[model samples]
Target: MPDTYNITLEISRYDPESHLSWVQTYQVEAGGILRFVDVFRKINDEQDPTLAWASSCEHAQCGSCGIMVNGKPLLACELLVREAVDQFNTHTFRIKPITIAPVLRDLVVDLEKAYDRVHAAKPYLMKPAPAPPEGDEYRISPETLETYVEATQCINCFCCATACISSHHHFLGPNAMMSNIVRLMDPRETEKKERMDLLYGESGVYRCHTARACSFVCPKEIDISHFLALGKEGKF
Candidate 1:
């Protein structure tokens, strides 16, 4: 095996100065063990210092380093360079900021709008069960919790939203709904009716057309289509 190889990245660049956007390509020398995020860092450090993107906790737990590579939205940190080349059968891959939002610069997208939907949906519990007295604690049986465990795994990366067909429009998007679903799944939550109202409203659950693209790109393997169905059926 060669010690190093070059990979080409076709990145979409937007210039705020002139209000122009274009695709620019860059080549990075990569080793076998590096990840896609590492390639971006190498580009920033060695090739173009002006390049911009967002990332935190590069461990794939923060969900901050989301980008579309080869027309698929997924976490950059979780995808390795070697795997991408092997799976797609090419060392050259096209990358751009996920759609359904405004681009700030290069790979950075404005997430506040999507976050607004999450906040509006009341992502947290309105009526959380109070802690038990003294040494006791509110508890849930494992069996009941198992029903919605996968839904609770959303990292809020907005990958699902980018993949959602209805997201670029008025729809609230899947990950945002997943946030609400997480709270609704809790047996201790008291406000099911209110949650249901928001989820079923216009631009709510029904907006999902069941394309299942969000579930396919989810790094957590969340059953997003099932959640959309459950929400539609008032089963949440």
Candidate 2:
């Protein structure tokens, strides 16, 4: 038979209108296999309808449901109950919104705020000058594409931003930095010096102290610090 576990949750709550932030506790009974999302679902369904959080694709692929579980940034959908217990080393889980983000309600944060720097960096491909001289000239070697492929997997979850120590400053954080690197690695991008200037600018890659907290909390297991280090060396 599947096992059932009793868990205690201490969640942070904020009221936008009243400017109130507080912590509340709840006792829940859940299956041992259930994820943190499931626990939150139970809380919303039965315990408190007013509680709020964000969740989609409940498998870590969407990168939503990012929150601080016992002071660690993580995807609520991906972290199992047993794993959370072991990771936190406590029976009661203390949950809150990730750092460096404005809390929209309770667990849900202002995703737009997290995306601001990325928007400023121009994350998408710039249209080639002169329209690329027809389509055939735009292709890249398979080996070249392979180099930056991993960087493209960033889901824009903002977990890295939460884990970053320098986020208190104007630093752009991990996802935005990776976006800059991806464009740098792309063979067709022509403004190499311009992109590098942005990457190395104030609140840029130089601000990262290589704490690797961003890499450690990333649900995707991306080597974000490695990319920044390579960027510093101008290795591309």
Candidate 3:
């Protein structure tokens, strides 16, 4: 068996100067275990210095390397070269930036604007439940935390938002909805009613079609659509 395979990447390219977009192709030899980030690095270092993309921590914790591989949202750092080939049954891969936000350049989107909904969700505890006794800290049981812990794993990659069937203009998107749900489930938060109001508001959980595409694309494997379901049913 061969340790390396020649792969072609059809990456989306955007030019801010002319406001044009096109597909740029590059062929590189990749190891089966090499991740897509490594492939991107190889391309940038060897073939094209003009290519641009976003990446912070290469460990998949920062969620900075989010992109669409054959129209599927995924973290480039987590997808192995061979895994992509096997998943699509092709040696050529199409790479595009997530569409939830406007593209700034090649493979880079405006993440600040993309996070607007998440910011609107108010990710912090707005209202406190109550103060703990003097010299004592508030305690939350693991059993209770388990209910919403998965939602907290979201790194704001916006992959779920990109994969959502609902239009971002009308829906809060999965990560934003999950952010509110996490706060609502917390025993330390006393602003449940307000969060619930927002959840059931015009651009809220109701916009979700329960397609579960958000769950399918989440790099963290979080069941984001489940929280949307719970929110729609007023379970939390």
Candidate 4:
């Protein structure tokens, strides 16, 4: 039989209409490998059907299930029961929504609003360089792709934004800055001047205090601050 743990989850609950909030606790018996998403599912299945949380593509690729586990932003689908218990050295875990956006419900935040800054960065390659003479494949060398490949791995999880101390103070946060940085480093993108303007704008890289919290809690393990630092130096 797999080892089982009796875990206690103190989840933060919020009702937007009443603007009321509270903590609700649930007890669950989970196997060592069971994820926190599975634990939430079990709670909804057997204990509380009214529980509200967002999740899709439970493999940690979608970043839909980003939440705070014991005060740290993390992907719920990636945290295992045994790992949580061992890391915190406790059977009880405190669960809360990521602070990057306004909470809409129990563990659910308004992700669309959170995506505004990222959208402002214009994540696509605007002004592509003439499409490589029309007939030939627009090929990019591996060496060129390597320049900003890691930044492309960002799933827009907002975990980095939540952990960023700079985000709360009119800053565009780490991932949003990385979005612009990736485009800035891409050889195909020709709109460098516009991106530079945005990066140096009021809510841009200048607001970053280099707290490194964004790098610390990123689910993708992206060194987001490093790229932002590069942006600070105009290194692209």
Candidate 5:
């Protein structure tokens, strides 16, 4: 680990009833290997017990530690404090909490709306496969698997949704489009016509204006714009 450096975090605080919001600042010393989650945990333990945040898997698999770092959406668990210092050009870094939506507490934003939007897209396998062919298991070609590989990497973190200005204003979001594309691309799945109907219908894939912000903020680095492009071309 490299030498510890002092950093400052500016968190956005919200109160639901009063519609009041404020920013709270915390100073901490972090090493090169330390992540933003580590800084929050340390602050909660030593400085402010009320400092709130969320995390799971701690390894970036859960996608629970997503937050805004210097105005961009990022996975806190995957972001190193040293990298942040270098980006901001300071031993002391400024961390801004997400403010686009209702803050559940400190770093936590209410994802229920995002989840509802995902469910609205009906992102599920609608296949009617036989009973494993009675003996042999169903197999897929490597090329087919590779086609949907990037779409499958999405962890449903809502970072894409948050970064999508069109979704933020009038549409569902890139996550839903990506999910729909994954299902559409699956070889075993039938019902492409129905899925495409849903995607191009009202409150569907056509709502996306191709802002591409979703792709930029995707923690998994999923190419969301590609899915939108395919959708626009009627290629699923």
Candidate 6:
């Protein structure tokens, strides 16, 4: 059975120059089975056609629909409105724009800078020369694969970045570090030492304060702290 209720969404809207902010409230008939993304779309179609947001895949895998729901970073496609009401025990879900970054419009945020930072990390595999003769695929044992599996789940949603206090002041955030860790832990990669050297540099993993905020807000449940710890201990 699905529970039906009225939800009040307080969304923050921004305009160019002087950091102008405004709030628009929407009354929605919602259920526990309906995601916030759907609710937002319904509200937009019915009440405010100018409401702006982002989404892709609508399955939490694309990581494009990240937003601040009741001051928490969440995937709009992943959370149901009624579940949110139950969790907070309130009919009104106050969604403010992300505080760490400048809001582009309604719910859409400017993640261009964050994406640039991610690219600067060069988070990718650098494989050695291919094997000769049979040229078989590189084999990774099951046990070894298990170790790096968690880090590989990142969808680059930047939710972790939104929650990270370190990134609030121009830090690189956790996603890149997580990416680095994945490659560092991969059995096929032979560039671990070189990658670690870059990661341990001033603007790299060393900037992390072990705040754990990144892991706390990650939709994928990636343990960013564990990877940071590994980097600190030179254990990767």
Model 6 TM-score? Answer: 0.90
> 1-236, model 6: which lDDT tens digit per residue?
45888889888877665677788888888877889999888988889888888888999898878988877888999998777887778888888655545678877777775577677766777766355456677767899888778888888888888888787664677887778767877767787777877678766787888989888988989888888778778765
Candidate 6 deviant stretches above 4 angstroms: 17-19, 99-101, 127-129, 132-134
**What TM-score do all the candidates reach, one by one?**
0.94, 0.92, 0.97, 0.96, 0.90, 0.90
**lDDT of candidate 6?**
0.79
lDDT (10s digit) by residue, model 2, range 180-203:
878988876777787888888996
lDDT of 3: 0.90
Could you give me the TM-score of model 4 versus the true structure?
0.96
- Ranking of all candidate structures by their TM-score, best first: 3, 4, 1, 2, 6, 5
lDDT of 3 by residue, 80-169 (tens): 988898889899999999989988999998999888888988998999767677746678899998899988889999899999999478
Candidate closer to the true structure by lDDT (higher is better), 3 or 5: 3
Off by over 4 Å in 1: 1-3, 132-135
* Each candidate's clash count: 0, 0, 0, 0, 0, 0
Residue 96 CA error for candidate 3 (Å)? 0.5
Clashing pairs in 6: none
- Model 1: how far residue 14 lies from native, Å: 1.1
| CA lDDT, every model vs. true structure | 0.84, 0.84, 0.90, 0.91, 0.77, 0.79
| Candidate closest to the true structure, highest TM-score | 3
lDDT of 5: 0.77
Alpha carbon deviation, residue 114, candidate 1 (Å):
2.4
Residues 25-94 of candidate 4 have per-residue lDDT tens digits of 9999999999999999999999999889999999989999999989899999999999999888899999
Q: Give the clashing residue pairs of candidate 3, or none.
A: none
**Candidate 1 to truth, TM:** 0.94
Q: How many angstroms is residue 39 displaced in model 3 relative to the true structure, after the best TM-score fit?
A: 0.8
Query: Which pairs clash inside model 5?
Result: none
